[model samples]
Target: MFKLTTAAAEQVMRAAKEGGTEGMSLRLAATQKEDGAIDYRMGFDAATEEDIRFQSEGVDIVMSPEDVPLLDETVMDFVEIEPGKPHFIFLNPKDPTYQPPADA
Candidate 1:
């Protein structure tokens, strides 16, 4: 299963609140490119019957069945890469370009 860091969860909640999607789950999708890198997308959305639902870091999440294998063991995090600049990042072992954090 995929995991979300506390920082990521807080940011997700803030975005959901600002976007007026309080009741909707965060939909996550992944696509594998020709180069074997995984592209990730996320947004607030309603869950469909074919979607798989789960909760992480107190945030609701939904994903299609096809995304399971691609996202398995993935970790999503929000970090400040530079002063006053924060961004979301995916540490996916399945992605060819993935690199382990230096501190890890």
Candidate 2:
């Protein structure tokens, strides 16, 4: 299953409230590229019958069945990779470009 770090959850919650999507799930999708890298997309959306739904860090999330395998064991995080700027990052081990966090 996919998970979100505390910072990511907080950011998502804040964005949901600001975007008037507070009750919607955070929709996630991942597709593997030819070279085994994963591409990710996300937005607030309503869950459909075929969607996989779960809660992580108090935030609701939805993903299609097709994305399950690609996102399995993935973790989303919000961090300041560069000074004064924060970004959302997917730390997916399944991606060939993935490297374990140095701090871990």
Candidate 3:
């Protein structure tokens, strides 16, 4: 399951509304590259049958089914870095681990 915070949802919804497209929904999707790395993309006024629409705080974020796995147990957060630099950050529950040093 994916989680979208109120702030993130609002910002996305506002942007979509300003795009002046009817029935437009924010879409979030990810794809596996040739190197097996997953990448994410966001769009406004874009959607497909394969996309999953997120509804919260009167806002929606559409995502493709293929991108579901990559978004599993993920959470979206809003952050203010410096001035006039608000951004969204995706957090995954499953993070890579680092190996511990061997006993000397």
Candidate 4:
């Protein structure tokens, strides 16, 4: 239960268009680093055993269920911090009406 921002959606759509894929999705998943730190990633594909794809407007983002709890009400934002080094920000828990998944 999530929505994409105009900018984020546009960026994703552009990427999908470039790739020329018939379908696209964005998946959000979590993983543990070698140091036991938890991290997340966004991928493009359909939902699978370890990947969940968020597809909309020709954009595809693949992720894992392990990160669903952290992605609730998350908003993707882009920032031009420096010259060409743009950064994407994850604004989590942004919606008061949003609910997070129970498990990680």
State which candidate has the highest lDDT. 1
Off by over 4 Å in 3: 32-38, 95-104
- On a 0 to 100 scale, what is the lDDT of residue 37 in model 1? 91
Q: Could you give candidate 4's per-residue lDDT for residues 1-104 as a string of tens digits?
A: 44566777777766667877546566665554566444556655666766655654445666666676656556676556599987655555643433454677
In model 4, where do residues sit more than 4 Å from their true spots? 32-38, 49-64, 93-104
**Tens-digit lDDT string for candidate 1 (10-86):** 99999999989998999999999999999999999999999999999999999999999999999999999998999
Q: How do these models rank on lDDT, best leading? A: 1, 2, 3, 4
**Clashing residue pairs in candidate 2 (N, C-alpha, C atoms within 3 angstroms):** none
Tens digits of per-residue lDDT for model 2, 1-104: 89999999999999999999899999999888888889999999999999999999999999999999999999999999899999899999889999999984
Candidate 2 RMSD to the real structure: 0.9
Q: Which ten residues in a row have the lowest lDDT in candidate 3?
A: 93-102
Better of 1 and 4 by lDDT: 1
Better of 2 and 3 by lDDT: 2
Residue 59 lDDT (model 3) = 61
Order the candidates by TM-score, highest first — what do you get? 2, 1, 3, 4
Better of 2 and 3 by TM-score: 2
Candidate 3, residue 102: Cα displacement in angstroms equals: 28
Q: Write the per-residue lDDT of candidate 3 for residues 18-99, one digit (tens) a residue.
A: 8775367767776656765556677765666766777756666678777788777766767786698999866654423213
| Overall lDDT per candidate, in order of appearance | 0.96, 0.95, 0.69, 0.60
Q: Which has the better TM-score: candidate 2, or candidate 4?
A: 2
lDDT of 1 at 45: 97
Q: Provide the lowest-lDDT 10-residue window in model 4.
A: 92-101
